[model samples]
Target: MSGAVWSYSENESVSNEVASAAADVAKGASAEPVVLEIGAVRAGVRAPGAKLLLKGPATSDVPPEVAAEAIAKASKQLQPAAILIGATRYGREIASRLAVKLTVGCLSEVSKLSADGNALAGERNAFAGKVVAKVSCALPAIATVKVGYYAAVESAGTAVTESDVGQVNPLVKVVSREKKAAGAVDLRSAKVIVSAGRGVKKKEDLPMLEELAREMHGALGCSRPLSSDLGWLPEEHHIGLTGVTVKPDLYLALGISGQLQHTAGMKDSKVVAAVNTDKDAPIFQASDYGIVGDLYQIVPAIRKALASRR
Candidate 1:
């Protein structure tokens, strides 16, 4: 039997990146015109003529429980063939809770989805994206895909009537809300990102990275080993297969060797520049611009040149 793939929508993700991936999967399904369902929480775009429904508003941080209840409710109404969610923290939580409640198989961090005969196929990262492992499951399958794994594709379809999920009062009420101070810079959304690796030698050397980022109007990022191993930078600033997948307009890698795992994360960036002492480093292959020199001299020169211009 064929099934539908559903994605959660959030207000910030109106781009519909996640929803588009779901539609792309639906197009390939054996089922006729895959059904697209959006939860009350808006993340991405709602496809035209797609079945839009309210799974009840999320109780802020209570998505796990809220999503479980919503999925159970949606199951009765849509009876989707399969459920697809993003691999985001909240999305994963929702998928996990729903999977346990429904007692069905669930795939996480899938980069590709397809059909192989009667079974569903999924491609996900393993050993830090070193290998792409393929998996399959029977019908009524559920999955959560990673961001940047699949690009959103346009499809020929129109919007359908809203399902009007009918409000179900939340059993759990949010007792308190704490807002953490925003970081010095929001690197995730920054157009340019200057990331460093272990080659920086010491945390005191980070000022140079920050200086370059300032001149370029970008934020700072670091490799996994540098941040996790040395604690030089916060975990939030790490970017790589083991860290964050970033698609900035411009990415400058200072002292980072382009490991397959690290390269996979930022491969989507529009422009990549690398500054490493070793000209044969793997990062140079992915970089649009390369500077083979000591970061100490190169970074200061670049900083001075920019300061002179400013």
Candidate 2:
């Protein structure tokens, strides 16, 4: 309540999202929201109110361990009331280390955050999303905000200050950096996604499902089995609890059993539609529109419907 609430993320896009989360929490506690930038300030990064640049380590990139050290050293002087980090792998490590260094509480994968003068409160899905758990920590705490929950802030604040936190060494040395495949997809930003499930019989049939997605101008996604077990698609395309969370305009689930793990990730979609041969499939319960039919027969019909309109 006495100090500013900070937001940070190693990823550029996720940083803006955390800014929005921090702003909401700051407003609840009557505090200012500040976005923290390490190494160098990024033009794409935004803050709901103010921004802080911590100079040290590499100007381009630094390991999470080194980043945690820099933030901990700087925080000793500035002393924020709360620190919100995006729930990215790098941010998770940084937040955990920062909390330990500061000897404060750390909340993981929480959203719908609030500040109640003395504490920070938020909600998190637990038990594979079968239950929503309410969790909180006292002020001067650290939290990792869930992705695909908050919209990214549109404007950047002009009030910014820079501090030299001093250079720090990394525990793990970088060997080499390789670019991802040319057409890698980020399902987080996709407006429309068609996800496959165990109902898909063979890997050879994947292109047919992919074609269906392309016909609807949507990206192809899958459940854990298709990606993890079958290796039909990369893990990036997997939509589930242990995979990526998506909040698309439309999420079409094909042959996916409405398992809680799978539904948890896509539950935030604006509209959900599912096609399964079994009328009692759990996926139908989570869908806005449910079709009790075979996807093999249904997919061609949907494609034909689209072609007729074109």
Candidate 3:
């Protein structure tokens, strides 16, 4: 019962969790689990009792064709009972292509997998985080496991084994990569966020929200309509269930009517405060603090108070 795990990084910790999970699945099964690392420059992984293999210093991100070829080579040699991959964007694509090449069934985003008698049982969420279901598959299977699902465990294992390097293909060459410029604050990781909606109207009114956010030492964010419809803010700053999910320490929604799609993404915030003219707005239900008044008059007054304090 041989198991295999792959990584795109030379650093073993990148796929260490997946390797450990593979080892756990292969425990007491009379087979040695192998941790295979595939890097542009070099590839190697570590576990207490499992086998570790490092290939070369190839590159950082693995190209789809190269990943497919590497998995194919390892499959031919190991005949692994199962292969476990992290369910990242790249991981999912690689696992799917490898499964097709290896002629095996591929499970995706599995939260749990255990060998039960003659079958492998998998538990995962479905229907957009609404339902949980279990699935079963036979041996020689492949699965893309969720990152935070299972804990990585370590135990005793054999000494390291060095395998000959596999074929290398340098088809697509990366020219360069650059990071995007950020504003004074980035809302994705902001501890506090103050957002506005269509009720604020006109692009000119955004300065009020910006002032409030600046006074609070936070970033200003908005709903899709405010960003996309009016072009008052960049689309990147939009926050809703369809957009980025934030767990800010405080989230202030001003002039925005609460929609479930928007709230679902922000409901996990530590503290939520809302300012809307309508007392019956859905935002009130989700807010830890609420102020009912016209945003035009109240927002400026709030800004003035904040300015006075500074």
TM-score top scorer? 2
Give all TM-scores, in the order shown: 0.75, 0.95, 0.61
Q: Each model's C-alpha lDDT? A: 0.71, 0.89, 0.69
Query: Taking the tens digit of each residue's C-alpha lDDT, what string does model 2 give over 1-310?
Result: 8788889888888988999998898885668898888888888885557789898766847778988998899899999999998998888999999999999999999999999769999999998888899999998899999987888867755777988998787768889977655666789988899999999999999999889888888899999999899888888899989899998999999999989999988998999999999899999999999999999999999999999999
lDDT per residue (tens digit) for residues 130-210 in model 1? 677888877677777777655554444445444544455666776876543356456657899999997799999898788
- TM-score of predicted structure 2: 0.95
> Which runs of model 1 end up more than 4 angstroms from their true locations?
1-3, 9-15, 28-46, 55-62, 115-117, 150-180, 184-191, 201-204, 225-232, 257-264, 267-272, 277-292, 304-310
Better of 2 and 3 by TM-score: 2
Clashing pairs in 2: none
> How many clashes would you count in candidate 1?
12
Model 3 misplaced regions, further than 4 Å: 1-36, 40-57, 112-123, 147-165, 168-176, 182-310
Higher-ranked by TM-score: 1 or 2: 2
Looking at model 1, residue 86 earns an lDDT score of 71
- List model 3 lDDT by residue over 127-232, tens digit each: 5344578987777788887654454554544465655446667576657755534553456568889988877868887897888888888888888898777777
